[model samples]
Target chain A: MPKIVDHDQRRSEIVEAFLSVVARKGLPAATSRAIAAELGVGTGALWHYFDGFDAVTAAAYKRVTERTNERIAGASTGLRGLAAVDAMMHEILPLAKETLDEAQVVVGFWGRLAANETLSAAEADVSDMWGGRLRDHLHEAVDDGDLASGTPVDGIVDLLLSISVGQQVHAVMATPLLDPARQLALIEQCLSPWRRTPRQPGETVTR
Target chain B: MPKIVDHDQRRSEIVEAFLSVVARKGLPAATSRAIAAELGVGTGALWHYFDGFDAVTAAAYKRVTERTNERIAGASTGLRGLAAVDAMMHEILPLAKETLDEAQVVVGFWGRLAANETLSAAEADVSDMWGGRLRDHLHEAVDDGDLASGTPVDGIVDLLLSISVGQQVHAVMATPLLDPARQLALIEQCLSPWRRTPRQPGETVTR
Candidate 1:
C-alpha cells in the first residue's frame, strides 16, 4: 500500500519549523536553508510545500494568528462583561515564557510589515479579527449594564489594543517597569470610567 | 589654503543621508552604497566619519532619538501638569507628514532591535528618558491637586508610553481607524480619571 501523506499536517510541520527558526534567530536569518535545517530536512523539502521563503514565512504568520485566535476564543469562552474582556486581555499579555515567545515573534514582524505589503495585510487581518472580538465583548458589557450607555466602544477598543501592543513590546524588551500585575491594573483603570454612572452634564464624553 | 571640513556637521549630514536612504528604501536596502548615492558622494566619503554600515546605522539611530527628544522638549518647554503631558504626547503622534516619517523609521527599527542587543539598548534608553519625563509631568499634576495624592504615577506613565508606542505603529501602518484627532482624544481619555477630583471613601480610585 502507498504511504499516507497528510498534506495539511506536513504544511503545519513546515510552519512550526519556520517559527522555531524565527524564534531562535530573528526573522532575517530564517532563510529556507535554516528552516530546513530546523526540520532536519533538505532545503528542497520546503519547496515541495511552499513556493519559496516568502511562502513559508506567510504560512508561519498565519499559524501565529490562528493560534492567537484560538487562545483568545478559549479564554473568553463562557465569560461575559468585564470578566470576558479581562480574560481576553490576559490571553494576549506575555505573562509566561511561551506567550513571551509569541509576543517576540509578533513584534519582530512589525518592521517587515512596514516595508512588505503582503505581510502588512496579513497582520491587519489578524488585528481586525482581534479588534472585532473585543468590540463584541464591549457591546456585551453595555448590554449587560456593566458599561454605561453611550460608551464609545470603538475608541475603547482602540485604546485597549494600543495598550496591549505597547505592553507586548515592553514585555519582550524585559522592561522592569510593567510586569503582568501592573499591566492588568492599568487595563482595569482604563475601563473604570465606563463602569461609572452615565456621563453627567458638562462632563467630557471621550469618543 | 586647505578646505575646512566640520567633523560634527559632516557626521550630521551623513546621518541625514542614511535616514533619507532608509526612508526611500527599507533598512536592509539602505546599504553604504545607497547612502553614499543619496548624498551624491562616494561610499568612501562615509568612512571619514564612521567605520562602516553598522556605524552609520548606529549614528542614524542616535540622531532619531535625539531629534525626538528635542521635539518633546520644545513642545513641553513652558507647559506643566496634564498640559505638559498632552504636549509631549502630541509631539510623538504622527499628526504631520514629517512626524509620520519619523514614526515609520522608528517602527522599522523595532524589528532590528528584536535581534540586536545594541539597538535594543539604544531603544530602551530613549524609552527610559521619555518615561521619566512623563512621570515628572504626572508628579506635577498630583502636586498641583490635578491628580489625587496617592495616584500611581509610575504605572500611569508606563500606560501612557505604551499607548504612545502603539499609536506610532498604527500611524505607520496607516491604520485608518485612528486619525490624529482621535489619537489625542484617546490619550486624554486615558488620563481623565487622574484629572478628576479626589475620590472620597467608597469612591473608585483609578491609578
Candidate 2:
C-alpha cells in the first residue's frame, strides 16, 4: 500500500501557505515560489496538491471568503438587526491588520480572476451571500424601528455591497480615509438616513 | 544619423498598443508579447521603449488617467456645482461601453500596482485630483443652493470618491446594479438627501 497522503489536508496547507505569504509580504510578493518556500517545499511541490498557481489562488480566495463568513458568524452571534449588520460589516471591512490582509488577498484574486477564466470568481455567490445577510439584518432593523419603515432596502443593499467590494481594492490601493474610524464612518453614512436616532459621539466601535 | 528612431513616438505607439490590447481582448491578454504583436513588432522591440512590461503598464496607466481627465474636462465644460459633479462622475463611472472599458483598464492597473512598487500607482494624484474636483463642484453646489447649506461637503467628497473607486471593481466583478440607470441611481442616492428637491422622474441619465 502506498503511503497515505491526505490530499484535502495538503491542499488546505497549500492554501494556508499562500495566505501566509500574502499576509507577510502583501499580494504582489505572494507568488508561487514564495508560497512554496513558505511551505518548506520546492515550487513544483505545490502542483502535487493544486493544478497550478491559479488553482492555488482560487483556493485561497475560497479560504478567505470562508474565513470571513466564519468571522461574521462569530462576531454577530446573539446580535440582531442593525447590531448584526454592523458587526458583519466590521468583520468584512479592513479595519485591522488581520482584516486588511484578507482584503489584500481578496483583491489580488479578483485581479487574477478578471484575467483567468479557468478559476472561479464565485461573484454571484459572494454578492448573494452578503446581499441576503444584509437584507435580513436590514429588514430586522426596520422591524425593530431602528431603520425607517420606508427604507429602500434593495437599493441600500446594493450600495452596501458595492462599498464592500470597493473597499477591498481600496485597501490594496492604500486609499485615504482607510483608517478604522473612517471605515465605520462610511457605514454610518449609509445607515444614518434611516436611523430613528442619529449616531451619537463615541458610539462607533473603533478597532 | 545611423538611423532615425522616434523614441517618443515609438513609446507612445507601445502605450497605445497596450491600451488597444486591453480594449480588444482584456487585461490578462494584454501581455508584452501581445502588445508587441499588436503593433506588428517582435516582443523584443518593446524593451527599447519600456524598461519592462511593468513600465508599459505604468505608461498605459498614465495614458488612461490623462484621457479620463480630458473626458471629464470636455463633459463638464459648461456645467458647475452639482451639475458639473454629475457630469464628471458620469464620465468616471463605468456606465457605458467606452467608460466601462476604462474602468476595466483602471482596475487591472490597480491590481498590478498593488504588486509592483516600481510602477507608480499614483494613488495620491488620482485621489487628490478627483478630491479637488469634487470639492470644487460640491462647494459650488452648496453656494448655489443646489445642496443644503449645512451639508457635510468633505464627507460627501470622500463618499463620492469611495463610490467611484468601488464602482471600478464593481464593473469588473459585474456586480448587480451596474447598469447605467442603477449607477446613476447611486449618485442620486448620494445627492437626494442634500437636494432641496427630491430626484424628479427621468432626472437620471441612463447612459
Task: Give each prediction's DockQ, rounded to 2 decimals.
Answer: 0.38, 0.55
Please report, in order, the local distance difference test score of every candidate based on alpha carbons: 0.72, 0.79
Q: Least accurate stretch of 10 residues (summed lDDT) in model 1 chain A?
A: A198-207
Across A52-88, the per-residue lDDT of candidate 2 in tens digits comes to 7778877887899999999999988888898898989
lDDT of 1 by residue, A1-207 (tens): 122366777788988987887667655567778878888999898787877665665576578767877887787778876677888787777776666777667666675565465665655455577778889888998999978887778878888878877776776566764577777767766776678554344542221
DockQ, candidate no. 2? 0.55
Q: What CAPRI-style quality would you assign to candidate 2?
A: medium
Off by over 4 Å in 2: A1-5, A120-124, A205-207, B1-5, B120-124, B205-207
User: What proportion of the real contacts between chains A and B does each prediction keep?
Assistant: 0.46, 0.45
Candidate 1 scores an fnat of 0.46
Which lDDT tens digits does candidate 2 get at residues B1-207? Answer: 323458888899998988887778877788888988898989998897788876776777788888889989988887888888888888888998777777767776676776675554444378778989899999998898888898778777777778888888777777676777888777777777788667678665322
Question: Which ten-residue region of model 2 chain A has the weakest summed lDDT?
Answer: A115-124
Off by over 4 Å in 1: A1-10, A22-31, A44-55, A148-151, A196-207, B1-11, B22-31, B44-55, B148-152, B197-207
Candidate 1 local lDDT, B1-207, one digit each (tens): 122458888888988987786666655566788878888999898898886654565677678778877988887777888778877887777777666767666766675565455665555366678888889888998999888787768767777878877877776566764587778767766766566563354542222
